[model samples]
Target: MTDRHELILTCPKGLEGLLLEEARQLGLEDAREQTAAIRGFGALEVAYRLCLWSRLANRVLLVISRFPTTTAETLYEGVRSVDWAEHLEPGGSLAVEFSGRGSGIDNTHFGALKVKDGIVDRLRTASGERPTVDKLNPDLRVHLRLDKGEAVLSLDLSGHSLHQRGYRLQQGAAPLKENLAAAVLIRAGWPRIAAEGGALTDPMCGVGTFLIEGAMIAADIAPNLKRERWGFSAWLGHVPALWHRLHDEAEARAAAGLARPPLWIRGYEADPRLIQPGRNNIERAGLGSWIRIYQGDVATFEPRPDQNQKGLVICNPPYGERLGDEASLLYLYQNLGERLRQACLGWEAGIFTAAPDLGKRMGIRSHKQYAFWNGALPCKLLLIKVELDQFVTDNRTAPPQPNAAPAPVEVARLSEGGQMFANRLQKNLRLLGKWARREGIECYRLYDADMPEYAVAVDLYRDWVHVQEYAPPRSIDPDKAQARLLDALAAIPQALGVPRKKVVVKRRERQSGTRQYERQAAQGQFLEVIEGGVKLLVNLTDYLDTGLFLDHRPLRLRIQREAAGKRFLNLFCYTATATVHAAKGGARSTTSVDLSRTYLDWARRNLSLNGFSDRQRLEQADVMEWLAADRGEYDLIFIDPPTFSNSKRMEGVFDVQRDHAALLDLAMARLAAGGTLYFSNNFRKFELDLSIAERYAVEEISAATLDEDFRRNPKIHRAWRLQAR
Candidate 1:
């Protein structure tokens, strides 16, 4: 019944040491590795040549019986002593599949219904007809396993999972399976860069699993050579002249690896709906003239290829498993490490991630990494070689040198409390950089904790420099408040001329519930600042508040000078930057509200970046159930909220000094008569519930909404207004 069988194989769990070195280079015998299989023995034509050449396998099996069960009646007496009328017939159909649990044969669907009732009671006691169970095309699939308590069973010879090689029938929202993209192109060596003729790419390619697994490892094709149907195609120990001599030697080594000369494989894909389904999965893996698929965009991924070729730039990117998707997948892995250091410089990248801290912000470095897993997540890959000394120029994004001057304040390498925090950050950058370039303000708040032993606040945004700190005070000394926060993050990129990766830092503490709207770094690095003249969208390294609020710039320039055709309303609209300054002061309709679907998707990308998303709106509920189911009124309201929130998407526990009188009586019942409202919060022991100044006339505009960069923290927030009288 065998010519030396045993096998096993499996895979995808960090590719069991690259599927035990490609099953001992296909001959298999005594192979080894285990967790995520490999085991091995051979013949039966090396498990039909690892089910037609294993590209990091996923099921090959074969074994047929191993026994020693501990329950389900000794696993139905080891599947009725494995005969099953010589591999399934008596009206053939079969399926099984069982996998691990414990000796008690813990449920894998009742250990696949007791091994399909011991292979239909041993083929209905000598062929009285019984088979029938085909869990989708199964003239006998079988498997079993059990482990530790031992059982094994086997047989599913390469069926539904040879990573399906059925040319991804349209994929994308996280795909990568084709044998984990052929074990990330055989650990990014891409078969010695396609045997030295070198040329591959990917640049975030999605439906093109690493350009059809690097064009079937550069043409030596046969990753399940157009897989038709297997799991031992209709068992009975299938042989058909030894599988037509290994399927006609893998279709003549895939037609002499596609008649040689084509290898410059490409891919691109910024989802123009995954570029015609990745060129229809490279024209169904006949590799449409050696991989191509375009629709570009990793910040202009350019790989014209054939200029003395340099191959291998692979990708997998988007490791952002939800939660604000790493703030734009940290600039899509820094625009794929700046298109591999400006267009594949000495090419050889790889990447593949599950957030190895967003692939170390892809400033590029990985001189080899590996790991792998993808199915139960795990991941990694990395590799890199696009050298310029592995490029990490403080996580890239450099470019600005026109007049190039500001790198001076190395204040003789600080440490006298970092030269008094670099002379109070060069005296608040020469007095808030001349009142933020004479009020054109590109985002301000220069220094806030002003020297309370570098408590920190910093701010800037334009030339980026966020900072924050202020956590200390547990009677200080946690290694002296982490050496005064490493002397104010080494004097904030040299007193702010910037570039310590344009400084970002965090800490601030004392937050609760919606913990200052969570995510402190997925790096989706937003930027674009401006202010009273509209532009907003700040991210500053994914949240702790950067979606603009430089002390609400004089109350969003007094809601863009009393929003013109007034209808505004903003309420806790954290990223609505005062509803884009009340829709750039025109506001005939705005809305905003927010229970934080990550700040209402950063207030719908700051109202679709300024064109004010056609009359704005946003509303991700619970701003007190959308202002008591808003009866639609608003003539400019603002609100702010959050001196404490409970945000399990709310329904209890908001305490801006105990729900500032039912949140200013639900914004004065959506105020329409004499409209007005405003009412801010930042707590600082808030109070204003003076029956809202006797049913609304109030005023205190918190010292005229303190601006010039938060006039020395005027409690940082507190406004008023009201009206409806």
Candidate 2:
């Protein structure tokens, strides 16, 4: 009856996939992910339900006009062309919001003013009366965006950023935005994980973001149920009847999906800085009974595996970018890897860190690495693929699907290059470890010679020996490998000469690479922030990702120290660890978004096995579409897109290496200005499109976002801090 209404739910760039999935979950089946927004046809009720439930969006923009216009005069004509009476009451107060990039009228404010002028002039000319302009609060809000010389006029359906989610009373530094947090969980693979008996865990759980998000995902709870109003509700076309129906259906679905197992989402952090905030946020999200929070250390973090399968080990460790010393972070990572390997045997583990060195410490090859923007800092999500006996793989060679954030890490081993160097390095590594062991030094070699290209990396912990990173010749080359192994066995006593029984050698193979952060960095030109919550050493270099992805790092830090009353999204997320960091920060719910199924599997292991959030989860799909169809807004969002990718499903042959302009434009469109978009890109040539919509300001924060090891390629990722104006 009411011309099938169309609305747009804009989300951070690269989060479209999770957003689309959110829409589908909320019964918005027809929902679809766009380049930077989600489009759907629904009644006002559907809009309201979306405002109340979506876990991965920044704002819901209701398109009022889609027209081709090249000049300000053309903009006026178009605005006048629309039936102003249908939206604004004759004398009703109205406000204008504008966004544009590479358009004839680049000034967002000027464009908004022009649109406002058009609406008032038309109303006055027609009825001898016009609506008054109200900047702060208005009965009607008109939103306009100029893109590539084109304009899309829309109504601000959700006046405030959906990230406000009507919760979050208390917060700490750089708390995760609700939508971003939810996106993170989705990227980590939440829906499927919560559907199964798997568990979710956030080791550095801060304010309870990951915890609440986990509960919501497990219970299928709408992320925005507590919100009271949406911009669309105040519009003249607001339909109470349809809105009520959508609300009713959403409620029914939520009620029906309320029960799930190992849904025991928990946030654990020793820092007192996050406890109160975490508690407050949990209550704000109305997840008191379902999720739990604790104050403790990750070192002592020992969680029991579920009877069915081991839980996921999700964590956002300190990259030392905003915290500690980067030169030695490898040692901290070494400890983290050792603990996971020794204590978490049956489970898989997933970690989210801007610093790849920290992930390497976990001693597992990453199967998936996503590029995400934590504000404007280009970063990666390294999904450590842990092999476990439980769980079977799903889907293979599927049709083209969706979009989301940026992530580029090693996808497969580079078998062609550096073979000779690898062999030499491997031989040297084994010899060193064996010499150390035999010499009886109270040390443990963490890596050894196994694969040929990796070239032998070893760690010496307190009492154990781990060896990996060595390249073996091949199946036909067992002799060389065996000779190296035996030589090293003899060398252990030669290096330190303890005893064969005291030495433990582990072989590791290099996997595919989506990114390579092997450059050397400069000295203390960067700052490193390490709270015990982050669990990392102070020195180290040559990490895959920087320590902090300005976009999501704050959320992870907040989870380690603050996530109080919000949901979190980690779009194009690699591991749910950042969500775990949010959980530690006290978030109520978390959704991890990503396209790699292998990473999702690791996400479950990281969460459940490590005793993080058991409810919040992993989602595998293209992030672009996910953001496009999502119905909810989050308090926090972690936007990280990849540098370059070509999959059968997602369109626009993406290459952060090239399309960063459109990429950032899409992400900012969905960000809650007062909210954040920690935009990050590793394209050494990465530069902010200062010309893009001026609605938000970009702050070059590469220095603050960098860790010591990544200094070699200071340009590896350039981070920008963004806030809606």
- The candidate that wins on TM-score is 2
- lDDT tens digits by residue: candidate 1, 187-236: 88989989888888787787888888878887888888778788788888
Model 2 per-residue lDDT tens digits across residues 636-692: 676666666665556656666466666555555555435566666655565566565
Q: What is the lDDT of candidate 1?
A: 0.77
After superposition, candidate 1 runs with Cα above 4 Å error: 1-50, 54-84, 88-122, 126-156, 164-175, 178-196, 199-309, 322-433, 436-543, 546-644, 647-703, 709-717, 720-725
Could you tell me how far off, in angstroms, the CA of residue 557 lies in candidate 2 after the best superposition? Answer: 46
- TM for candidate 1 is 0.37
- Worst lDDT run of 10 residues, candidate 1, spans 394-403
Q: Return the lDDT, model 1, position 353.
A: 80
